[model samples]
Target: MADQLGSARRLTTLDRLAGGSKKGVYRLRLDDQTTVILYVWAADENFWPASPTVPDDPFTDASGADLFAINHAALTAAGVRVPRLLMLDRGGRYLPSDIALVEDVGEVTLEALMARDPVAAAAPLSTLGDSLRRMHTTLGSHFGKLAAISRGEAAQARCAEDVVADRALGHLDAVATRDARLADAHDRVVAHVRHLRGAVSARQVYGLVHGELGPDHVFVTPANEPALIDIEGLTYFDVEWEHAWLRLRFGDAYPALRPVDLDPHRLEFYRYAQVLSLIEGPLRIAETDFPNRQWMLDLAEWNIAKALTPL
Candidate 1:
């Protein structure tokens, strides 16, 4: 595999960049003068974004990479600004099948920009809402039954169980007393969930959506085209799941959540789903990737507060 990664004719010059949990990414130049990004799969640990939620397959690392390829193809064909696929290798000796060679956008990721200026949040949040609306409108139905679209719900529930079992959830519970606002927020969220479930059926609200939506995945080019990447969390479930994830990351400052287009209930559902994703995902990632345990605990506490919320 090392030799394959280093080979210059087929794939050459892999300079490691950035990625989540288990995958290794690099900027490579193919012999065809095609500069592409390569993903090399190697997962020694599972768990991240930090909680004690074990993924469905604690050691299963290869599946999400392949799934991303499929999602990319679909999104690209639908006219979404997804990263173009240069090549795909699911897992093989000459070409490990799970990896992919994708076009590098060479632009600033929203995450980086947000880090530089978090106070000036409105512009990027609006841009994110517009991009999400485009995606949800264009390709949500093609992926699966509307209700099954958001995989985050299933993932989140499982993570909650795992956290309880592993005693990670206990960590957050311990801090609740000290953080009264966090506790109050948690209660409000729960009430919201109860109201939503009672008000509507899952079929009316579900569809395939980007299971994960955040500053990191939403990339913006100088031309203002917002390209969505990191398709690992794509799922077929409640369309609201997507909205919820976006709301959690970007908050209510989003421009499009007006009376006509946005549904707060759906956003609540998707947000809960995202909370589960973060819990299970980070708990399974390598420790080196998340050195600040306290920060992770803080995030987990926040998500947990969201997840257990009623609406």
Candidate 2:
């Protein structure tokens, strides 16, 4: 990989960027002072336990070359800002696993920006809101993965809310067996999810949702533009699904990321489901040797309390 690029730029430094549990994220600095990010989808870098959750369908932990390629195109076409793709190496002639080189968007994440200074973070957060509007308003004919949708085939005929409800139920069951507190509230949480799920009305349109979008998944460029990363799970789903996550992660800053006219019913259901996801996903990752084990466990425990709030 370096040999090819070395001819022109001369690769000088390679540092593994923090985060990215599913793929290896590395910053490659060339001798010329330019930088690029290399995404390596290999088993060694993946922290998810083998077969963590039973077939999560549309909401699965997404990764790999095919997904990245399709989603990048979909978001780009929708006028959503993603790190510009420099090259894709699917053949694996250089690296053992699928690798992609994209323009380095930089170190500043919206999460970091929000933590460092809220006053300065306002413009970028507002810009992120605009980006969300563009992404969500760019509707799709069907609700499913971008790869599936692009091939002119819908992933399912079921309502988008149904998918969330089902996945949430699965997470609830999985976590109950592991956590005592969740086990205590298992029946009640399940009932509330079902009740809310029943109240949710079916919809025809679906938006391009960044499945696990949070402030951390968003990067702010020097010009203060919001650039989306970890986009493999980009799909056509309920915009409220994305909004629920934004609400959870951004908190007080959520007003800056909120979209207009989100269904209250779907929001209620999806938000609860989001809590379940946080619990289940973190617990699953914690099963492996993820460096943030304590943090992950704390997240699961915190959401366990949040999960029972409605009841």
Best-performing candidate as measured by lDDT: 2
Candidate 1 lDDT by residue in tens digits, 238-298? 4555565556666544434331255565555434434644554443332444545566656
Please give me the total number of clashing residue pairs in predicted model 1: 43
Q: lDDT tens string, model 2, 57-176?
A: 676757889999999998888778899998998998777999999989989998999999898899988888888898889887688787766676665656777777788888999998
Each candidate's TM vs. the true structure? 0.63, 0.94
Please list the residue runs of candidate 1 whose C-alpha ends up more than 4 Å from where it truly belongs after superposition.
1-13, 29-34, 45-63, 91-97, 114-130, 139-196, 202-205, 256-260, 269-294, 304-311
TM-score of model number 1:
0.63
Q: Could you tell me which residue pairs clash in candidate 2?
A: none
Clash counts for all predictions: 43, 0
